[model samples]
Target: MTTPSPSPRLAGHLLVECLIAQGVKDVFGVPGESYLAVLDGFHVHADAIRFVVNRQEGGAAYMAEAVGKLTGKPGVCFVTRGPGATNASIGVHTAFQDSTPMVLFVGDVASDTRDREAFQEVDFSAFFGPSTKGMAKRVERIDDAARIPEAVARAFMTAQSGRPGPVVVVLPEDMLTQAVPDALKALPALNPPQAWSDPGSLRSLRQMLLQARQPLVVAGGSGWTPQATSALHRFAENWQLPVANAFRFQDLFDNRHPQYAGDMGLGTDPGLRRRVSEADLLLVIGARMGEATTAGYTLLDVPVPKQTLVHIHVDAAELGRVYQPALSIQASMANAAKSLEGLTAPPDVPWAEWTASAHADYLASLNGAAAAKVCEGTLDMAAIIRTLSETLPPDAVISNGAGNFATWLHRFFQYRSLSQGLKIQLAPTNGAMGYGVPAGIAAALTTGRPVVTLTGDGDFLMNGQELATAVQHGVKTHVVVLLNNSSYGTIRMHQERAYPTHVLASDLRNPDFCALAKAYGYEAEKIEETSGFAPALARAMARRGGTLIELTFDVQALTTRQTLSGIRDAKGH
Candidate 1:
């Protein structure tokens, strides 16, 4: 019996089919002229893969990152070469910093135009060098079609292994249209061996942890599965150690757990920093110990010696790259955590005293003015998070943009379930506005759950066009915009504090977001008074599809929450 040959179309379809087999349900991209062939391929399997058309490639890629963070799967984004791929660099870098898994498929210029400086023809491998784990260019031979699964498998493996990140696969326009043999149809399953710590290293780490009167466990980056988190939880509970999340990775630990010490990186709880610095041993896992995680890399300020650092990360490059460590183990976070769990016998330490201090500090931090006073004349950001926590199902995913408003949500909003926690999908370092709406759309589409995006007036305007996409796709996402009628609320606050006499390029005039949403064919409403917020939110969430609620609040209502510096540097301060 001879095996049947697969047509080019069939091969393309099978490539996507394997993606579906791997649990990929949502794909974010903006179709361009170059990717029409792949787009055509996608059209055949539209039911299996939900395609979301984003207004910008960067936004689409960021949306993929959001989906990946929320779902714990490799988020996929498709793009055309040249400008389309270039625009996605921000998102790629974001996934790198956040350790989120993502697969980026870029449509390349034809092989004929490879080096002719053809339109939209740039070396994608060179372009994505620093941002992605792996980059595969278009292969011409029919035999290379089988390599598609290998490329994809490696991409996913790189994405989920070590320091999780984005991986790019470039398909030349011609290659995507090539025919292949049927024998290549069966996708190879990827099962990389788990990287375990050496028995001697594990023993040394266990002894260090056990002997320390004050030991702290710092969690960061990605590669934290349910099993890894569970092991950490069990270890923390067994030894009564205070567990602190590395900056943005707070979602990995249960906030309600008595041993949880809250976030510990930049703008972290100051009290938590004091506690970490005072610890005799710092057991760092998965985290890169980046400058942000180490508060500008001032590891000594925390009063811990270089010899006290026991750093464990999947990437050897990351181990001791920032903070000198007495011991560094290059292994998988899950495997390392499991090994540590077995090596360490329970220690007799004053767990309650450490926990009591942390709990007291957390309570004090919450009682600050930032947590008090619900919105005066508009929807209070804090109240909205509290209400959402109370109203939404435990497993609902929430995606947020980077802005002053997001800071409030981060500090006040508590996740009952890991699946529903806040995800910083886009690279927050760039602090780009207008990602919340599209990201919310992507999250809802990917997770099949209610998606809530918290944005400010300035941010909503940046990506406001996405409301139409949401409505067109029948994506039921709730958009809550804090209408401060100002650009850069944090900057404005800083100006007021530093140079009270002058305010420049900070004040803003925004259009009526509610009216704008209505123009985009969405159910829209405006809430100016805090009193009507609950009823308005209920109405919005009850709607079957998209709803935009603009909450107008005074600019003075801006307050710092979950931030390191209470004030920024302006002319005076």
Candidate 2:
């Protein structure tokens, strides 16, 4: 008697189960016509994968980035073909530049519909080629479904490997409907090679650092794991090296540490720039050295006497892509840091003198005109940041949406604890706005940790509708909305600087965000005075679920703790 064949549906179900085994719990996407089959599969396995439906494909991608940043895992975003895929590109690019691990799954038209001008047909691979680490299209045969697990493994491997980036997997409509045998469930997850730094490269890098009278280390991206961060701090401490975090990575180094220099961004401390330029050797690890991170890529042009640049990155393409490096080593940032630690003996240098000077400068800068600018108003950005820093639990995770508000957070906020338990997560580098709420939601849901997401009016409105998602999932997040009543405060700052009399497209009138949050079933409060801020935050945090605290401040009060050189440049200064 012939044996009965196993159901293909079960095979498809198992394929999804394998994904769960890989530790992917959160997915972002807006359901589309072409993705119904996968949606059905997802619904069948809803217990394993928690899908967060976003209002837009771009929003979904940003949400995925948020998850990646918070969990240090590959966040997944699903979308349909053509327009859906196109809309998701912004977030993918953000993930790529920021070195965030993410997977973008786009549903494709059926294989038969190729070149038929079918509904939602597009060259998805070509579209995602520039922004992703790897791309693949779906195959229909049951045996082809075997590749799904391997593909996902490879995608995640590439995403977290060299320089973390986004990966795209295009699924054809038929592939989701196709079934595989139950026996095919034993496929193993693909394990990518862990490429270590060569001894010679590590020796050379060490020699360069040792020989230089003034050496500096710059950290960026999400490549620095907890172990790596500890190793880095130890290395810096032992060798008496000064370290500066790129952009929002200040938490990577203890702000109270003597060797810690302020971050590099629009509001970068002038003293930090001076120290960076004075360094004889510049060691950049895991950082892309992107335009924004490098002050429009002009920081490299600063004259450094006897400058020797050593860049360690996972992605070979990023080694010398921005500022030309004297030595570029392609290896995992963690592995490279480990190798460097083994190779370099601690130097006998008075690092305290340099750090003390730098710290003094940073403190003076904070107390100077910048501080005055931040504290002029009753409800200033600096005060809010200080209050939050003082009030929040030491281990509370803070997520900020990209905007003028983030600039303030980056400059003023300091993480005191070096323990992994008190760390923070922000957008890698792409500085994508509208990710704060979703990321806070993911963090709260994944860890049951208290989360606060700070966003500006423009950014909140971008993906504000996701409030419903938070309420649906029972994730409690305290959202602090900075009501600036402007579309782009940074741009307006520039426009005002350039043409003060010319009222450009900078003004914006927005709806009452607190009322809107209440309408969406969140406990919402509007904060118009300083006295109400703490009570509102306390009430919001007391809630078992999501809450929105809308804080209205003078539009002119929106200023970054960092200097706004972008506006200066825009004004032809």
Task: Give per-residue lDDT, candidate 1, residue 8.
Answer: 42
Q: What clash pairs does model 1 have?
A: none
Best by lDDT: 2
Off by over 4 Å in 2: 10-14, 131-146, 302-306, 343-347, 368-370, 416-423, 561-573
Q: Give the Å error, residue 449, model 2.
A: 1.4
Q: Candidate 1 — which residues are off by over 4 angstroms?
A: 1-11, 131-146, 299-307, 368-380, 417-432, 477-485, 493-502, 561-573
Native-referenced Cα lDDT, model 1: 0.69
Q: Candidate 1, residues 45-93: lDDT per residue as tens digits?
A: 8988878888888888878877777656788998888899888877777
Candidate 2 lDDT score relative to the true structure: 0.71
The Cα local distance difference test for each model comes to 0.69, 0.71
